[model samples]
Target chain A: MTALAIGIIIGCCALGAGIAMIAGIGPGIGEGYAVGKACEAIGRQPEAKGAVTSTMIMGCAIAETTGIYALVIAILLIFVAPGRFVDILTKAVRQIP
Target chain B: MQNSIQSRNPDRTTAKKPNKFVDFLLVLMMILPFAGCIALKVLFGNPGKGINVTGAQIYFTVKMPLQDMYITEGTAVSAAVVIALFALVLLLTRGLRRDPDTKRQLVAEFIVEKCDAFVEDNMGRGFLGFSPFVAAVMALSAFSSLSSLLGLYPPTSDISIVAGWAVVSFSLITFYKLRGGAWNYFRGFFEPIPLFAPMNVISELSTPVSMAFRHYGNVLSGYVVSTLVAAGLSSVSAALLRMLPGAIASFPLLRIGIPAVLSIYFDVFSGIMQAFIFAVLTILNVKNGFPEEEYERRMRKKQARRLEREGKKRPEREKNAA
Candidate 1:
């Protein structure tokens, strides 16, 4: 029974990690769109390449915030959640039986 | 490695080798750790427990004997902070000359000039006082994050340290906003409708949360990945050498070159980039917190000064219209 509970906890954490990483798509699309516009602007004004690149980098970093948050959540689920989950599960199981 | 090899070859051809004893001592110091580990393993029975590497393994935790308290990431961070402060003081205390004669003086001047320009660019010249704080944050973050490369746990990897920095920046933002005007700063939250106030408050709160998490997550992730890679490599090599007798099976030959290449990106590039982003975000948030009217007044004053410098008289008609 303990083994089954542990398996369930690990499986749920793996699923949560996968779901969390789905947030990566938003940043991927947003950053790609931003870079595309930046490229167009640079093409239009070659002399302003430095300004365009700096703005693009700043914008890209801000856009990456969501993706970074998702990554943090995923990392936590993978590395930290299982230990806490086991502790909680064991306590609950002891009370139930 | 190439530079060391070249220097060694030249020294061997020379009649007099300088600091040969010191060089031997350095090599011995480097080897002492592996030698000790081997000696401990030989003395004790092998439990056959493979290296149990995990995120927690990267951190060095020291527990106090009498209390439940423990010191972890603060150790590395405080050491980095002290070293940075000492270096800064040492650099500044060297006699100030019109012309910087030594390399250290030149580097110090370069850093000061660059930090001044960065602060001015982001927060405007009126907020030049913030340059020192910004410079310190950037220096501390970069140095602490990069310290992980030296096998010390980086302080930025600790969420609490990053959160402390973020909260300090948030407090500065709030202080500036209150200085601008308390009534309007509070009223700004309820703008458009009362329903949006909670949303505004949440957005305001998330600024620090996001800032803290971003730095912590990046550093910690890099540390975890590199550690896992090292552990994986060692385990793979160990498994391959299992056929060999006893001690030879445990040798980790594959753990050298590959991780160094990964560290260049994870440790060096990410460390510098995260430090820069943290400073830039701090400047942006602080500058954004100032009242719009004050900002406009400063802009107008600057424009008037610029026009005056060009030998143009202020138009009486425009002043009357204002």
Candidate 2:
């Protein structure tokens, strides 16, 4: 029973970590695309360099929002960890049943 | 090198992209710890299990044998060693002599020149005074962000660091206003609103706390989650994969692949974004000091100007004069 509880707790943490990282996919693709477009715009009108650069920066910043969300989740798991509680709970339940 | 700069055009392909090696190195710094964490998980057990709590397996250990000090996981000593090493490297790099004629040096020169151009084009030469502040804060945040991702103790994740940065920014604005005029700085705060002065003051005091907490909270969260995930998954896989024969033992990717994906999100994506957000917020706070006052002033001035153009004054102004 203790073994089963431990396994489940471990599995949840693994799954949670994976879920947190999934947030990165959006920004990775978005930032790359933004850089490409910004470069293209700069190529078209060098005179609009200021506008292009600022817009690009602003867009990239916005793209980072998801990453921040993921980071928050990751931090929560490490610092205020509750996985052990699950392990303990399951173990007690198993003992009773 | 000079020729490269001279011929360099933003529109032209002749302009070289920034060194990919540097980018790779920066990214590597963030992942190194995760790699270590995984290795430790397989060799030992999960270190983060009792990381911060009492009565838990002390994640860190130190032993002195034969007049030599040895340290183990979860010690501040580990962080100190890394910081000391980084500082040493920085010092060495600082002492290196660069040939102005070399391509690499030219690249550095080009970046500085581009930065100057950007500042001048947007905020003018007067803003150069603030350029160092901007560059320093951004660079530090970037480095800190990367370090966080790598599973290194990010100094920026500490409240002390965040508060320190906020204080620096706040002091700079205060000094600028002092030089500009006491009334100007005092007036600057009240420019946007005179009625809600108390609320403004409270927020002004709270900015440092919020700034620090925001950065620490975000980065710390990422570190914790990644650590848990790594610990849990590796233990499961270690047990499961052990049951398999030698053929399957060779390829642990079945277990590791999933954790790697999580690391990517927490380390790569969250790390960089949080750093950028911290830097951006720092810049914004500095730039938009007393925005409410500024807004109110503009509104009042516009009203007065409109009344003047119409050959009639606002009732408030008329009443004041009367």
Candidate 3:
């Protein structure tokens, strides 16, 4: 029974990690749009290629912050949160009257 | 060495042989560690049995008696930081050359000049005072992140270290803002409407948190992913080798090539990119806190006063402007 409970906790955490990774979609679309525009701008003025590329990279990196945050949360859930969570659950169950 | 060899091997076939030999040596160097590990596993019998998957292997922790506090990877990281700083100081102070004749002097001059130009371009000329601090932070961040390549846990992977850096940057930002005018700085928080003050305050507070997390998250994620990939590779190799005879069954032969490719991206590219971005953001934030035009105007006033003190006649245009 304890093994099943621990497995369920980890399974749920894995599900949460999968959910968290969905945030990557936003950055993917946003960066794609920005890169497309940047390419068009660079083509219009070849002399501005360096500036356009650097700006695009900077903008994309900033836009990637949300995705990175989600990744950090997912990592925490998968690697760090599970053990502490199981400990808490076990302690609470033991304290029941 | 290569030039001398090339000169001796003027024939096309001879030159091609040397090139091939060098390529072979490079490949051998790359694969040497994996080969050694496999050999050890075969001789020692299933070394992977001793591998610990959890906190035991990944983290190095020491307990402090005073508060029972756990000091983790910070111990290794702080030692690396101290060594790096000592080297930096030695490099800067040891050479007193009027003209850079040696390679070391040339490299030192290039670094100093580039750092100065980077600071001046971003923060303006009069604010070059901040260049040393910016250079130190950039060096620290870059070296700390790249330290992972040496198999040491990177300092930036710890959130607290990045937070400390962010706090220093935030304090500098606040100091510069206050220098502009304390009353204006306070009033600016409630600008355009009083209702927006709380939002303003929250945004101001979040600056340091975001900065800290941006770097810490990037480095830590890279470190975690690489470790996971390595473990996964080792397990896959172990399983595949199980099909062999008992002596070689436990050897993890396949754990060689893939992790090296991943490390190039995670350790090298991301580490350098994050360091550059951190420095860029620091310069931009500090530059924003103080107005360049105001600084330039003050400098002009000071120059005018100096000229007057010397009893030098101000130019006609300068007199009219003053």
For model 2, what is the alpha-carbon lDDT of residue B270? Answer: 61
Tell me the TM-score of each prediction against the true structure.
0.77, 0.50, 0.78
Candidate 1: tens digits of C-alpha lDDT, residues B1-322: 2243345445333233235465455455544533443343344323466544343222334567875453444443445455655545454435434433556557777787899888888888899889879988898889878766665567788887889899999999898877646777899899899999999999999999999988888887788788889889998888899999988888897897888888998899888889999999998988898886865665677788888899999778757745
Which candidate tops lDDT? 1
Error of 2 at A30 (Å): 17
Between candidates 2 and 3, name the one with more favorable TM-score: 3
| C-alpha local distance difference test of each model | 0.77, 0.58, 0.74
Number of the candidate with higher TM-score, 1 or 2: 1
Q: Find the candidate with the highest TM-score and give its number.
A: 3
Better of 2 and 3 by DockQ: 3
**What residue pairs clash in candidate 1, if any at all?**
none
* Residue B98 Cα positional deviation in candidate 1, in Å, after optimal superposition: 2.3
If you assessed candidate 2 against the hidden native complex, which CAPRI class would it receive?
Answer: incorrect
Comparing chain B with the reference, what is the TM-score for each candidate? Answer: 0.72, 0.55, 0.72
Using lDDT as the measure, what is the rank order of every candidate, best first? 1, 3, 2
CAPRI quality of model 1: medium
